[model samples]
Target: MPPLLRLVQQQGVIMSERKEGQSIEEIYADAVHWHVNTGGETIHAKRMGGRFRSLKWWTGSLWLLFFLSPYARWEGHQAILFDIPHRQFHFFSLTIWPQDIWMLSLVLILLAMTLFGVTAVAGRVWCGYFCFQTVWTDWFTWLEDKIEGNPIQRRKLDAAPWDARKIRLKLFKHSLWLLIAILTGVTFAGYFTDIYRLWVDYLTLQAPLVAWVVLAAFIFGTYVFAGFMREQVCFWLCPYARIQGVMVDKDTILPTYDAKRGEPRGKSRGGDEARGDCVDCKLCVAVCPTGVDIREGMQEGCITCGMCIDACDSVMEKVGRPKGLIRYMSEKEMLGERLPPLYRRPRVIVYSAIFLLSVSGILYGLTHIPPVELSVVHERQPLFMQMSDGSIQNKYTFKAVNKTPEDLRLRLSVSGVPGLQLLAADGDTVTLKSGKTIPFHVFLRARRTQLKQANTPVRFRLQGIDKPEISLEYESVFIGPSKA
Candidate 1:
């Protein structure tokens, strides 16, 4: 049987067995009273010390590179730079020009494929750990925690009347939040320009107008979204949240509540005699960043950060019950079905295939990038000039682009017809400016008697004098008098 079909069958069996113990009316009654989190009230989630919480902190810290990358130096230049004016992307030893923009497309494709593949296997790991919104929100809340104390204290402060102490605390927290926001803005702007120079410019009040506008926008965005808006940004602003439904399947693992084990709902006393594992403490909701009650079933608000699982496990430990009352599990697994291996899943297989294909294409494009690009345009007006010496002369304009950083002297030569000579303003050598296309007129003269056909194919070769390895070739037609 197909994996999906088998999973459906197993789910049917589990549902039937669970329902046999209780009537449909009873199940409906239980579900109707379940805790559902809407964005109506302020959720003051309790902070806890746990394994997943620590993992979240470590993973979220990776964003620090964004603030520091602009300061990195390589070969007396920014280590990684996107020089938009010059149409070049410099990465240490490698310099990519507009001619290599196809690689950028491949890179984007690879990233998208990776995200899709991971989403198919595990739901929203990117949003939970690596998303800028989540990371910044974490930082902002951590600062809030430091200034205002725990969740209860924060709630109290929020409800408290405007006193001198409240004013002072609020002012201090807002000031710090604004400072971090401004720093984030400045750091983002630094990526486009020199970080050290930008700091100097800001200090001297000599920065460009665009820089100031970008800084202000970033500061406002970060402060409002990370500090004030918080999970509301994820709930309403993020497009990924809307599209994630299509990427996930039944087998996708997510932080979930084991309803079967935790239902028939009774509170745990000092001993385990009277009820299911869940003590109805609501600690999961207390610790949720989005204030979602995992036991209520999956909802749009859950970031899958596993904070609820951590909170619930701590509660379970305290109440002398086994952990994982809430845990990471697939819908299929919860329904008592065997999950197919990751490679066997259709979505994973398809996404991985596309990911590999995109990677291969990018590698091929990079490896085969030509050092220099050349083109020759045959002058349309008077294609051939009959010289006094009975030679059929052709006027050709040579355009050679020196893509490298240094100016180069190139030697041009034409081949195909016998008894052909090149007449230029100079010898075979011509000077080309670095990163510029140089257009020059060249005369290709051949004895009419030596011409075999009216339009004979010829090839032009341009070789750099400084580096023989840097060369390009173009094929053109060598014109002659029509056969009578």
Candidate 2:
């Protein structure tokens, strides 16, 4: 063949191989690397570094406090403890008893509202950054990434036949996962009991049944959910994901694909000028933890983790194109609509208002938590009896719960019943155990002639003998039979 003919043949071959203006369907066909899971297979999410990735690491670090707090000491006692056995929550200098459980409700409300408000503003920011499920799953995947290489290597290993190398890697990875799971279980249990003692018990194989159960459950959950289930937990198990639709709206910013800027996908070698920025690479799909293509539009499987954004940005940078092929944006912003201020959005305003109210209530409850709880129950079976000394006597039972860590001595007395005399079997002073409720019988006597009504309001007060500032009072009715 002539030289020109040979050159033309080579050019024809090159032209036939050069892919241009690849339709979305063709791109989808090329993306055999990713699978959108539906509870059938494990997802191996590719991990990469970016601004949001660093932010995720920082937020995940907060859970370290959960592990370390039980070891913290406050005046020779655990700094923070649930103390479920004793029915008290100790926080540094403050002790909360069952009487103050109302505060916990406010605390729950505060947390719930905060989650709602954040979701309304930025979709699944918690799932991406702070949620324990997400954090633990990220950690598990990170470990997997380090040990098994990237997602492709992990899948290959998974499909590889049983062998020494594979077994060794699997064993090491699972061993570390189980270690973390056990630590998570123990750490969670520590919050309820003495952490040091709990550790000793576990070491000695003497942990209580409940402690063992908690450890087993957490271990199983962490290993399965974080190590195996990964993002599927966010998809199916989490109620927040389902309800976040209502919380998130057109203004809610999320990891979004700019279809206007990224559509008309083509290949790098094609040089198709009509095509948008996307190169049909599917790097975004490859990097997604949930395997949902952001270009398909926002779906429940999307955790809004921004990994896709990072992946897309990296791809764009490599292609010598401007970044933000996928970016954090709202639907309205994508549509070129001006966004209202946070205070102006009705959803945001309502969420913020409720969040503020919940926070205020929690703060109020914490500040106003009574140092002690006192109750007096008038003996109801007999109401009142006539004493031999020509006085009407009322029997009462006084219960006092000392919220403080130290024992308290209280000078118990009564008033508001004219000519009334207070008497107790244990004398005028009673000692209360720290964080324990003690009940004692008492008597109130008044001259029958001085009694003017069938029911008289009476006041019971206890003055702290050692701590005069710590005092409590209760009011009760001194009842007698109605006049015939």
Candidate 3:
């Protein structure tokens, strides 16, 4: 090493001197070489079974619902179909039409606020466990580990010339990854159409162009991203990672290295009075998916997965010392200060307020979505038509959209002016098909004397014939000649 660079490194770091243990010399030798990932090489992270590892597995498993939900049957139909062609989103018995799409804004807000709140409280827990990128990458790496052997072996294999065995393993691993990608694509398309029928269409080569396009795109993206990019996606591609710094504060809990406790570092074998607890094994670095050295202070690459904590704890255990060389702690706690309550944090308070408001809006929208919608347009060409009986008549275009799953037979009624009558709607009912909008003409007639003014306020109502409780209304105007 250059004397200048070594001096610079030693100036800040507490260096170890003269220590015992079989791995002590090796630790000191490798400690000076540990560096962060710079997106230059594929990080071959070692897999270790631990509590946080198990937690990651469980969180990743939540995505199973994305694959399985389209198969669920409700009232003999796909339970969670988007039905884009019909412009309706079906969720079990609930159907959301285009008019109700405003609720999606609130739903999006709720999700965003949830992510912000969680990030503010416990740094990047979503990115570590729940994010699709992290989850898919985890699965992809697991398959790679099983097929390519441990990290050291894998690195050796990469350097070695590929022959028959290496070729076989690479092909097998890639095939499995491609299969997963294809399944992910199919699952995504299933949400827009019937899952069983979609599969049949694909097998029979009868699927639509849009479905094929979506499937192909998802397949390619999943394969390349999860199989190759891995943590680079989090480091460079994800916009949330860039903004997460703004949401997080000193109070946020993160996987932190206790520098004060572990510095002045040396070997763990003897009670060396000149050194602290850290042995500098670099096992924490080896096991890191993102190759972040936690000892360098919190960097953008840390996903707060606590894998370092698990690794450091294991190392401490092996050295016959108390654990928590690295742990989940706020900066305040790390500095031996009192950790503030959640409500005391301004960011948490703001995020919680937004979250609660968005949730309230979503709930209100869900409960208040009407089963039917109505619109009425008065004729524009001829304002009013004179009837043979000398009663002024006005023509109107009435349109009704049925949002319910069942066909509706509704009785039409008009009200507002005294002696007003429905010239065409007397004892008449309109039959509306499920999820269909239909328009028809209606005529309203009244005496010239009953008009009272140039224009009169008119109201139209559609009451369900069988279910009287379900009704829709529209307010319109009666156009007539101006009063003298």
For all candidates, the clash counts are 0, 0, 0
Give the per-residue lDDT digits (tens) of candidate 2, residues 11-111. Answer: 22122333698553444444333345878977777788877778889999999998788999998899999988899889998888888788788788778
RMSD to the true structure for each prediction, in A, is: 3.8, 8.6, 5.5
TM-score, prediction 1: 0.90
Q: What is the Cα-based TM-score of model 3?
A: 0.91
lDDT of 3: 0.85
Higher-lDDT candidate of 2 and 3: 3
Worst 10 residues of 3 by lDDT: 3-12
lDDT of 3 by residue, 370-449 (tens): 88888889999898988888888999987788888889999888898888878655356888898999788899989888
Per-model TM-score versus the true fold: 0.90, 0.91, 0.91
Could you tell me the lDDT of residue 393 within candidate 3?
Answer: 90
Q: Looking at candidate 1, what is the lDDT of residue 312?
A: 85
lDDT of 1: 0.82
Per-residue error at 430 for model 2, in Å? 1.6
The prediction achieving the highest TM-score against the true structure is: 3
Compared with the true structure, all predictions reach lDDT values of 0.82, 0.82, 0.85
